[model samples]
Target: DVVGLDGAWVNDFAKQGAIADLSALMTEHDYDDSQLASQVEVDGSTYMVPAVNFVYPLYTNDALLADAGVDAPPSNRTEFADAARAITEAGDAAGTAMPLSLETPSGVQNQVMSWLWASGGSMLKDGKPDLTNDGVTETIEYFDDLYQDGVFAPGAFTMKEQDMVEEFTNGRVGMMVDSLAHLTMIRESNPDLKFSISALPAEDGYDGKRGIPYASWGLGVSESSDHKEEAWKLFEFLMSEDANAELASMAKAFPGNVASVPDFVEDDELMSQAFDIYQAGYPANEFTGLPVAEDLMRQMNEQFQAMLEGDITVDDMLETTQESWSAEF
Candidate 1:
């Protein structure tokens, strides 16, 4: 039902008061959600709903897993590494390529943050920067290790976005992480490939808070909409179990309403596997007072890129990062 670039048509209708309600990600939960903010409250009235529950996970090659003699499914870091190492060996023996790939700067950073979150650290705390903490150190160090271990290609710093998918689909990479909706794309790429998803392996450091970054699209109704009642009705219908099931099929994503998609969930094995991780994966912005998250992401990506290129030292990143956070605070 949504058809314009950047979902602009919906926003237009919202602004015009022509559309009284909208199904958007902006207003799905009550104010109790620590990670989400309300966008529809005006003059003591509410006008939006948000429906997002799944984040992208990496898809792994089953044949590679079998060939490596690794465990069937990894539950923790030890198992994940053992599997990765085995895949590398198997690829080497078969004269194939690496088993992991993703070129997005933010994607890499998000993965790194999950390691940090799993290790119990975050970019901001109470509107302040917390990048110099121990968890961040280990996370970045781990990434550096992966980069240096030949696990990543020599030019990871220069790779393009879709290239990662191409690498995986071409069988040059055994694992690639993207949107949860990628299952459809993956199926289209290799109809018969033995692939499955697993929750991110847990960390060994600290308590391992079990965290992962979340990326989602959502629905929202406009406060200015004239069809508020109709919009609400449509919103409820779209989120209904049956409608959500259909949506899951069309969008290749989990339905926004958690309890309503039982049948769809029961029928989808990969979604089931990914949902287990979704349960443990909390938002990166757990610290309520954390400074503006997007700003920090942009800044950190720039610094991290320099650090990876050997143009900046970890200490330099630390200094700048702390300073940046301090200014923001």
Candidate 2:
């Protein structure tokens, strides 16, 4: 049986032998996945075919930045922090929106992890948990400083992703790191709201290619499927350049096939800008193929909230999170 799944859960299914490896089928059909945005592999065996990617880019309120006297989008962490603080101080809107709700803890993956990834930081070393590394340490410290400065939108600990989007759409926040898939919804929500999309700011002095976080819709076959050949036919069609392009266009997402460009890029300036950013950076989502990925994010989110509330030191938060993640590994 063929199945659609979140790219992140591919590994879990593969580990349990619940999903069939698509490598042999792909080879038999002469299907090339080299051009795809990401491949879900477990123990060097491909188990999932990515269909579309929803990339997370920085979204800034044009009027808010202008009112705060910020002439341009921040390129580095220092500038981003200063600009955020300035926006908060200049008006009622907070500098940035952060949704830290434990119920939907992927915020740690989409936002918190994106901050680290943007600057070439990694929470994994040798494909395992390494949350206490210098990069992660610095990232946590940076957010802690922002929390202390009160630059994050209110109710962060209780806010969900949709709430964060609503905050930005309503002019309650000056900036946010969100998915490009939301562009249409955002514009339709408030036709007069002026905004721009750009890459997430890197750390100061970091000059390497940035890491752009992404979520993907992936397809796979059931391990016990009787109609394996039929499923392969479906995969072949969907991954074809033309079909992939159409799907991405309908979803307003980046095509899974790198060679297939989306149609929206031509008519939408923001989409065009997002494409440029994607081309300049690498797709990054460390949790995509990990075991118990969502749980791991929730674990980190809890520690992060504790740290933000001053209930734990950064070191304590990191140490606690590291231990928790290692247990799963």
Off by over 4 Å in 2: 27-30
Candidate 1 lDDT over 1-329, as tens digits, reads 32111121333344455333322332542223232321222122322333543464656777777888865766556666666666776774221122122233454444456545554566655435677876676667665555555565434555554566566666666655555755667689878778777655656533544565444444555455555556556765665667766765566555455544434556677777676666555544232213344455556666776776678777787678778758854
Tens-digit lDDT track for model 2 on 70-112?
Answer: 9988888999999999999999999998899999998999989
- Model 2, CA-based lDDT: 0.90
How does each model score on TM-score? 0.70, 0.96
True lDDT of residue 108, candidate 2: 97
Candidate 1: regions farther than 4 A off: 1-49, 92-104, 118-120, 205-209, 221-249, 279-295, 325-329
Which pairs clash (backbone N, Cα, C closer than 3 Å) in model 2? none
Q: Please give the TM-score that candidate 1 achieves against the real structure.
A: 0.70
TM-score of 2: 0.96
